[model samples]
Target: MKRPLLKIGELANLANVSQDTLRFYEKHGLMRPSARSEAGYRLYSAQDLQRIRFILSAKEVGFTLKEIEELLALEVTRDEKSCQDVKSLVDEKLATVTQRIHELQRIKKSLQSLSDACCGGDEPATHCTILEALSDHDAGSSLVGGKHHDLIK
Candidate 1:
């Protein structure tokens, strides 16, 4: 006879994620493991464990669950096209990382300037220079230079 299946809670504990996170992964198509319990509990397999680990690793590299699903789908196809697709995905991820790095560098410079301004003459928060710098001027007179507006938007 086979052993009984693990419930969602047990499987989630084993995978080092909350049960809700596992459900979210399933909902997002990053994981499509079978649900065998009619009472509506989620059942998991060994492959599910590996897939969860794969999701965690992908997240560490900044891949969204959508990206993970795309990558996993390609991997399962077992075709020469899989290699080409993975390469394309990696290239896209690299460009995203590079863009993020540039944005971070710009943010760092802005923060440094703000900090330096706030530190000038040891002014108190009630009259904070940084706060003054952050105030919205007339659009044509804004001091943000060329920083992208998406962060505020």
Candidate 2:
């Protein structure tokens, strides 16, 4: 512990996060109270600042709050294998991202074909290829398949 631990506002500023974010992290169990001043203000140690930095970095790489919380929980428990678990979680996230990219490509191709068939400015509504493609289909009809439609929804 260091002398004169920082107050909540000072800690938030040092962490480059808002006071609200600090509160949210506490609520989510990612952060814990260090100590309290005589008037009931929260105090944070040097270790708390380091933890906040780690959390923000993780978030920037697409780790959700829950994921960060899991990591924090592991740290709290002094789990030796937590580093391995982090790598696993990152690999899983990368796979999900790749899948999403492929799905987006499919949706883009579908929309392009339909849209290219109709000139945006000159086409009459009834004769519009986009309109025809859409209107000709029944309920649940889309140029794109169900998976891409589900994404749009």
Candidate 3:
């Protein structure tokens, strides 16, 4: 029995994505339709549906589109080796996420310190510590770990 080819609308509906998103994926070569109808409408097969699902799943797991493209480029001919390769890719992504988390934490601390410096009282804005700190290039740079702490006035 032949599986019916799905039009772009049907595939987008089934995939829970907008038709424009499907076109975007297709335009990026991330997901290509298996064929086109005589009228030039994009047509997808069951395999295409699965591929789109994989791409979406990867994105949800924090894979950038370029990383997903690299993943898609990986040729897996054997199960054991393929599993190892996939694991390596996952490990790399995890490391990237961990580094990003650390950077965000540092930024969070800096922002909190800045916010704490402001009393939020009825005092004139001219005397605001937060504003003063911002205007002081040396102090501002040091807050973000720049090499200007020694230059603080």
> What are the TM-scores, per candidate, against the unseen true structure?
0.50, 0.50, 0.53
**Per-candidate count of clashing residue pairs (backbone under 3 Å):** 0, 0, 0
Candidate number achieving the greatest TM-score relative to the actual structure:
3
lDDT of each: 0.69, 0.72, 0.76
Give the per-residue lDDT digits (tens) of candidate 3, residues 1-153.
989999999998899999999999878878889999999999999999998899999798677888888778766566886878877876886777786676566555545556655566344343245444444534434344343359657
Pick by lDDT: 1 or 2, better one: 2
lDDT of each residue in 16-98, candidate 2, tens digit only: 89999999888978897588879988889899899999999978867799977866664322565676776676677678668
Deviation (Å) of 81 in candidate 1:
8.3
Give the top-scoring candidate (lDDT): 3
Question: Candidate 3 overall Cα lDDT vs. reference?
Answer: 0.76
Give the C-alpha lDDT of model 1: 0.69
**Shift in Å, residue 87, candidate 3:** 9.7
Question: Please, what are the lDDT tens digits per residue for candidate 1 over residues 15-131?
Answer: 789988988888887886565678776787777788898889878767787877876775434577677877787788678778767655655655555666464545453324443
Mark the 10 consecutive residues where model 1 has the least summed lDDT: 130-139
Regions more than 4 Å wrong, model 1: 1-4, 76-153
